[model samples]
Target: MKVKFYATFREMVGRKEVEVHGVKTVGELIDYLAEHYSPDIKRELLETPRVGPNKPIDGMILVNGHNVLHLKGLDTELKEEDEVHIFPPAGGG
Candidate 1:
């Protein structure tokens, strides 16, 4: 699957996009990414006080322009051509 990182997430991963194999679901993919990147990324992406240490924030992951929450949550299935975008919430006033 092709996973794309945007904004602060891109900086955190040090890459705009990455091709990973054996990723079937959103949750599985997130787990893989957290394990592959630096400890800082793992901490920031995975360690949320609200969701505990394993659940990533719902608003952080967008699957093909649609938030995973509206889809199948973390179990959202992904295909080879599907685009998964990871981004932090944007805020400006």
Candidate 2:
């Protein structure tokens, strides 16, 4: 499977895409990334270690073009060739 990052997430991994295996759910993928890449990514993406709702990070986490928040959240399932995209929270009015 391929996990693609955008905005700040892209900066965290220092790349736009990464290949991963042994993950079947979006939550698992996040766990795997936290272990191998940076734990901070997990914190930010998961919205943990946060303060109120004004944090600098709060983005859309998508799986195969579907918003995880509307699905099963981090429990969203994944299959082979599935693509994950993390986009920084939108701004401006």
Candidate 3:
């Protein structure tokens, strides 16, 4: 799978995209990124803890142009051909 980083995430990882393997779910991919990239990546992706049964995410994670929050949050499944995009939180007025 090709994981693409946007905004600050690109700077944190020092690249725009990377080839990730051995991860089947969005959560697993985040763990892999934190290990291979920086711990900040994890911090930016996941926020606080699960509220009830919903996983609260800090930023936006999209799988094939679909928001994971709308799917299954971090538990969203991934495929070898899937394109993952990660974006940090944005604040504008």
Candidate 4:
């Protein structure tokens, strides 16, 4: 899968894009990257609004040009060729 990070996230991973393999869900994907980056990923993308300690994040997560909110949230399944774009919170829009 092709994962792209926006805003400061690009700096977080030190690259705008990365390729991840063997992740079946968005949650799995996030966990993979967060391990390499920071736990703040869980805080910023998954832990915001405090839905629950283990609840999925409702941040702006897009898979293949469609929002995961309309799909299955973080449980949304992924394919080998899917494009995952993560857009962090923005200011001055």
Candidate 5:
């Protein structure tokens, strides 16, 4: 699975795309990424300070142009060739 970070997330992660191995659900991917990155990213990605591995985020996570929320939220299963996009809330007027 290919995970793509955007905007501030990309800046924080320092990479646009990351290829993960043996990841089944979006929740697992999030846990893996948070463990790899700095504390800042871990906090930003997690819903609460003491939340579990599958905590949901207020932001949006897209799987192949489709919102993960519509599929199965954090439990959304990913397959090879699938593109997962994480985006922060957009604010404009």
Candidate 6:
């Protein structure tokens, strides 16, 4: 599977995209990234929003353009042909 990183996430991982193997779910993917790259990647990808529902992470994880929140969250299944997009928490003035 191909995972794409955006914004500060790309900087955190030091790459725009990567090809991962053997991860079957979003959670597994995050674990794989943390194991291979920075351990901080897990916290960045799975932070809980301070003032929202106490679930879904603060950032976004998408599979084939569909937000994982709308699919199965961390349990969302992944396929080799699927494209995963990871975006850091949005911020603006």
TM per model? 0.76, 0.81, 0.89, 0.84, 0.79, 0.89
Expressed as tens digits, the lDDT of each residue in 1-93 for candidate 4 is 999988877777888899999999998988999997766666688766744544456457899999887899888999999999998755565
What's the lDDT for all of these models? 0.74, 0.79, 0.89, 0.82, 0.78, 0.86
Candidate 1 local lDDT, residue 22: 86
Error of 5 at 32 (Å): 0.8
Name the TM-score of candidate 6: 0.89
| Candidate 1 collision pairs | none
| Between candidates 1 and 3, the lDDT winner | 3
Query: What is the alpha-carbon lDDT for the whole of candidate 3?
Result: 0.89
Clashing pairs in 2: none
| Model 4 lDDT, residue 62, Cα | 93
The alpha-carbon lDDT assigned to residue 22 of candidate 6 equals 93
Which residue window of length 10 is worst by lDDT in model 5?
47-56
Q: Mind sharing the TM-score for model 3?
A: 0.89
Q: Which pairs clash inside model 5? A: none
lDDT of model 3 at residue 17? 98
Clashes, model 4: 0
Write model 2 residue lDDT over 37-90, tens digit each, in one string.
878787876664542444423577778898887788767889988988888666
- Model 1: per-residue lDDT, tens digit, 1-93? 788888877887899999988889887888788889645544555565645434446237777888886788778998777888887655578
Worst lDDT window (10 residues) for model 1?
Answer: 50-59
CA lDDT, candidate 1, residue 33: 87
Poorest lDDT segment (10 consecutive residues) of candidate 4: 50-59
